[model samples]
Target chain A: MNHKTASNLALAAAFAGLLSGTTARLNAQPVSGHEAGVSGAAIAAGVAMTAQDDQKLPKHSCKGKNDCKGQGGGKNAGKNSCKGKGDCATDGSKPKN
Target chain B: MTLLELQRRMEQDVRRPLTAELTMQPRTTEGESMDEIAAAYIRPNSELTSFERLEIYNRQYWFRVIGAVSEDYPALQALLGDERFDALVLAYLKQRPSTSWTLRDLSAHLPQFLEQHAEFASEQHRLAVDIARLEWAYVEAFDGAEIEPLASDELAKLGPESTLALQPHLRLLAVDYPVDEFVLAVKKPEEKAVTSGAAQLRQANVTTTLPAMAPEQRYLAVHRYDDVVYYRTLEESEFRLLKALQERKTIAEAVEIIAGEEQVATIQQTFALSSELGWFCHPTI
Candidate 1:
């Protein structure tokens, strides 16, 4: 067979092997790192040093209009600071505080 | 002025860029003095001048928006440092104001914004853009829609012509740097007492020296499993196959696309892992 034909045959064999599910043993090897390229030990060390458990779910927030109510602190506490100051000229609501 | 006109005018005044000192600019976009603009509409109380009253809103507006953007792009903030990141965000917000009610959509255009305005990222331009993209993917994966995955029986029914859909929340990214690890490291929950609200923004700005990362093509799948967002690295062939499947290509077509590039064993592993992970779903008719 020519080089091109040989290459095509090899590819076909690869596909056939994949379709037959013969590679489960290889895939069964545990993947602990976020990236497959990185080793599990390295990932473990990185996680241990800095991050929370990688498998644990993160805190998910619901973003609604009132969701930012208590967030009016720190440097961005603009809305809260100006709330009773009658700073909003167009809203027509007078200072209530 | 009509209420509508007054609302528009007030919005225009409030949304104007803050000065370098983080206070309201003295002049409006039309070159009108802010004092003159404020005097035209506001009724000053005994304690404050009309201009000061207006300045409060302007400063507050800028601070709130700046804080919101900072919260979403902490990794980018670390990459570019505080001063430049603030300038970049201010520039971005000016060109593309938040159209949505929620701040969740605030940084949606940030990745593209960084691509067009590379100077804001300083010398780490490419890495900054990659980090922004990765961070945005985290945002999406955190809240993106979840659909029922196709069952194993459904997989058997999928032929060369039968197309499959990947989960909507699965974000396939090709970045020029390995930003996944860096972002995870930066966003790692603080080991100490957890704080919330705008205070979190102040605490979020702890600066770290940007690590030098070599430029290499990295493929990532930013996905949410259970309720948590996770990043997975993919080999080139696996990436290609997933991308092809995402494009609604038939199983055969996707397989054909990646067959030459990957080993038989690797391909088999990819399929098995993908199926087990429920990456594939039936396309909506």
Candidate 2:
């Protein structure tokens, strides 16, 4: 085989080996008959999405005062929202008479 | 003078940088005496002179802007002690004054500022820059923007010619320091102490020396999920792939760029994980 065709075949073989179970997983899904002509890359993408759907990505939430102002899930998110706290000037005071 | 001219001059006075003691400078940039300038615009009251009244506005201007910047980058403050941090912020503000109505934009230029002024960060310069970038990413992810993610079934449509776009809020950063953990460490705080007040909390959190870390390369994805910003570590291959995709490269082109750079197994895993995270969307035409 020529260099280009040989490399392409090797790449396809590698992908076939890597996506073996992935294609199986995709196949196990209820086929709506539309998946018949799906390419291996498409099958791999589908498997990845299905796996992600099954297992949610781990997330890290802001801690303590680091939580953002709006969107009230944090301990000090709402009402206290960390604004107008005299943290800045304009301490909400009137000048003495 | 016209109201617009008067207002412009007043704003110029208010936005000028303060002295070492946090007081207004004695003279303007044009070498004019500040007291003389203030007299022309402001009326002296019983308690204070025109210059002193203008100083109040000037100092308060510094206070509000510095406080806003401090709020956004407490990690940077913790990295460089309070005094140096304040000076750095002061110097930065002097050059890039707040032009946006929102305080959020105050520190937008901070990362670039640190890159140019490595002296501010000293030996920890690179780490400081990385932390600044990561912290700014957090600020952006806080409320930057969000678009509907690509649906699962749409994965079937991905092909060699497909050009996938990442979420607008997703930020990719490659740094020479593991600033992701460092920022988290700096921010993990005594919230109970804040019960006293923000100022008191600020006082208590000052001089908090975190454990030192060795320099290490890190790839990060700063993204928002459900309104909470997060830092997700990415493998080198994954980072490169996402970066290529971000540049509007086709999936086949992206794979070709990274295929031989790493083992095929690594590429396969990276592809799977990135796909699972729903980081892709149809390219907006």
List iRMS (one decimal) for every candidate. Answer: 6.9, 10.5
Flag regions of model 2 displaced more than 4 Å. A1-97, B190-209, B260-265
Docking class of 2: incorrect
For candidate 2, the per-residue lDDT at A11 reads: 45
Candidate 2 per-residue C-alpha lDDT over B26-100 given as tens digits, one digit per residue, 9 for 90 to 100 = 997789999899999888876567887777667666666776777778788989988789778988988898988
RMSD of each: 7.8, 10.0
lDDT of each: 0.68, 0.66
- Model 1: CA > 4 A from native: A1-97, B189-211
Minimal lDDT window, size 10, model 2 chain A:
A46-55
- Residue pairs in clash, model 2: none
Q: For model 2, state the Cα shift of residue A29 in Å.
A: 19
Q: Cα lDDT for residue A13, model 2?
A: 34
